[model samples]
Target: MSRRPYKPVMSKTWYLKQPSYRNYMIREMSSVFIGLWTLNLLIGLGKLIQGPATWSQWLALQAHPLMILFSAVTLALALYHSLTWFRAVPQVMRIQIGTSFVPAKLITNAHIGAMVGFSAIVLLATLWGV
Candidate 1:
């Protein structure tokens, strides 16, 4: 007699069952938006390379209400992805000094601080047309 191996079934939304699992799923999903945003940027670059008319059209397309909304959503997801990534850094990276390891909060806070500082610099430069 041949016996079939039993396979356990799980819910499609099993990730929603636990807070950690849900967060993990959300973080993973955010990558899709980030990737799409990056793809949009690449397309814009290609349009720019195609010359002034194409570039202007691409810029106009970005100015549309739907594109504006999409940018806002993408920005939010990117921020969430960055924060979660910073939080995970300390867990994955063990930075040791003598007999002690760096605190997770310190590592995460440093990353956040650097991000803010760089963002401010970029904003200033953009505003100043640098």
Candidate 2:
């Protein structure tokens, strides 16, 4: 194999049409951003699992004003991501319940219902079933 010098030659037109350029910049941007926030969530979980002291420390950190502000932003973005994921479940897995073809919207709504129900269960458990 002959060795060739790597030239830093660039062309705007070619880069514009490059699939990597489009995929890297546009299609995967939000996924990457959410991936970052997901990492944060995992780290938070890890800290919480360390023990009550660590978990309380993390909770106090969250109550700080700036953290609270960013938490609000990430919360909204996460909700948007969750809804998008839930909406795609029906498309990804078509359900045939019993003898009829269930609609995609109905399946998506069921997914949303399950999510809400799970949240309610947690809330009720926290409240000691009052």
Candidate 3:
């Protein structure tokens, strides 16, 4: 008789068992949409490089309802990913000031603030065409 290693049975939805696990899975899954968004942008860049006609067609394609919906979903996932990453930063990065360490909330809040500030700058620049 040959002895075989036993494997424990686990459900495919094991991550759904805990809120943290679910969130982690969602955060990881968000990368797929983010990757799609990156690919979309790269395609647009290529179209732009091809010439004005191709760029115009790409821009028109983005105006479709389906593309708009995809953009919205991707934007939401990207924001969630960013927020989760910012929250985890405190745990992964330890910063000390003299004898004491900075509060985790402070670190997270600073990251959120910076994200907002940079986003605002980008929005303004885009609106101003500068």
RMSD of each: 1.9, 6.5, 1.8
Report the C-alpha lDDT of model 1 over 61-117, residue by residue, as the tens digit. Answer: 999999999999999988998999999999998899999999999999999999999
Which ten-residue region of model 1 has the weakest summed lDDT? 1-10
Q: Give each model's whole-structure lDDT.
A: 0.94, 0.76, 0.97
Which ranges of candidate 3 are over 4 A from the true structure?
none
TM-score (all chains, Cα) for each model: 0.92, 0.56, 0.94
Candidate 3: tens digits of C-alpha lDDT, residues 18-105: 9999999999999999999899999999999999999999999999999999999999999999999999999999999999999999
| Candidate 2 RMSD to the correct structure | 6.5
> Which predicted model would earn the best lDDT?
3
What TM value does model 3 have? 0.94
Which residues of candidate 1, in runs, are more than 4 Å off? 1-3
Best by TM-score: 3
Predicted structure 3: lDDT: 0.97
Candidate 2 lDDT over 1-130, as tens digits, reads 5599678867765646877665344433456656776786787899988999998888888789987777676666666666777877887888787988789999889989998899899999989965
TM-score of 2: 0.56
Cα RMSD of predicted structure 1: 1.9
- Shift of residue 92 alpha carbon in model 1, Å: 1.3
